[model samples]
Target: MSAEIRLPGLPLVALPGVYTPQDDTRLLLRALEREGVRAGSTVLDLGSGTGALAVAAARYGAQVTAVDIAWPAVLSTRLNAWLCRRRVRVHRGDLATALDGRTFDVLVTNPPYVPAPGSRPARAAARAWDAGRDGRLHIDRICDAAPRALRPGGVLLMVHSALCGTPATLARLTSAGLRATAIDRTAVPLGPVLRSRYAWLRREGLLSPAQETEELVIIRAEQR
Candidate 1:
C-alpha cells in the first residue's frame, strides 16, 4: 500500500458541502486517459463530486455531462467547469432519473462505497460517502443502469473501495451483459470518515483490527 496522492491536471473548487476530489477520483482520471476519449464523444460523469473527472473529459475533447443529487456538488461542478474553461452539462437529480433518455459513449463515476452502519445516508454531505450497510447502494444502481446508459460498445469506468466487493461489482456488470474487469487498483490509508466508524466496520467483519488501508479499484466495463 502506498500513501494517497492526487494526480495533477486542472484546478477544482468544491463548495463547502460538496465532496472534494480524492484518490479514487484521481485513479478514475487515469483510467479515463487510458481509455482515450475520442473528440466529440459523449461522456457522462455520474456523481460528479467536484467535477474533476467531468472537466478532464471535456478537456480531452469529449462532450461531458455531470450529475449529482446534491445542490452544492452541482454548483461545485459547474464552478469547476467554468474555472477550467470546459463545457460540461451538469444536472441535480437522483441517479436513477438523472439521465432519463440519455446514453453516452463513455460513463465515468466514483460513486460512494463507504460501508456505513445506517440503512441509508441522511441528506447532506453524508450522502457523499455513506452508502448502505454493505456499501453497494449506489454501485449496484449504477451497474443495473449501465446497459441502458451506454451506447453499443461504450465503456464504463468506475472507481470504488474494495471494502464493498470488487468481485461483486464485476459479477453484476457481467451479468448485465457488459465485459467487465478491474483495470487498476491501489491501497491507501483510510481517511477520517472510515476512521470514525472503525469500530463498527471491524464488528461488521468488513475490516480487520490491523487494517488501516483500504484498496481502491477502478473497474472498466465495455458494452457489447
Candidate 2:
C-alpha cells in the first residue's frame, strides 16, 4: 500500500508551547496507517507532539510509547491519550538518550526537520520544528538509533520535507543497516514557519529563489 493513508479526526489537545499537529504530523499518521500496525504491536512514537499518532496506534491495538523532550508535550500527550481513551506510555527526556534499553516492532517519528540558521532551540516553542543548520540533528540521531530501537523484521516510519534532503535520510538508514525508501510524497504550500525563513532558506540554497512549495515524503525502513 502507498504511504498516503488518510488521517481520521483525532481528539487531541495541545497545550500552550506544545506543537499543534500539522501537515508533517498528518503525513506521519497516514504512513503509520498504511503500515498496518498489528494488534498488540509494540510501537514507539518518537518526538510525539500531541501524541496523535500514538493514540491512533493505540486505537489499532498497538501498545504505544511516546517520547518528547518538552514538558508541555509530555503533558499534552498524556492528556490527549486520556481524552481518546487510549493507553500510551509517555516519557519526557532528550530524544538522543531516551529509551536506551527499549526496542519495538515499529518506530515512528516526525521530528524537528526544519532547516534553521541557528542551533536547535532549547526550552522554546521553536524546539518543536527547528533543527540545526542542516535540519538533520534529530533526523541523524533517529537514524542512528533506529537499527537498535527496532526489533528484527521491525519497521521505522519517518516523514520530513525534501528541503532536508530525502536521499540523505535514505542513505543514512541504509548505512545503519536497514532497507529504506520513500513510500509517499506530496507537495504542500510553505507554512508560516517556512515563509518566515524564506530568505534564509533561499540564501542557503535549501530552497530555490521562486520555490513556494515544499515536498513532504514518508520514508519506510525495514530492519533485516
Instruction: Using lDDT, give the best candidate's number.
Output: 1
Model 2, 32-131: lDDT tens per residue?
8889898989999988878889999999999999999888889888988898899999999865555688889999998888888865364488898888
Tens digits of per-residue lDDT for model 1, 1-224? 11222448687767777777788887998899999897999999999888899999999999999999888888888988898899999999876766698899999998888988865445788889888998998899999999999999999999999999999999999999999999999999999999999999999999988899999999999999
Q: After superposition, how far is residue 157 of candidate 2 from its true place, in Å?
A: 0.5
| Candidate 1 regions with alpha-carbon error over 4 angstroms | 1-7
Off by over 4 Å in 2: 1-7, 120-123
**Local distance difference test values of all predictions, in order:** 0.89, 0.87
Q: What is the TM-score of each candidate against the true structure?
A: 0.95, 0.94
| CA displacement after TM-score superposition, residue 34 of candidate 2 (Å) | 1.2
CA lDDT for candidate 1: 0.89
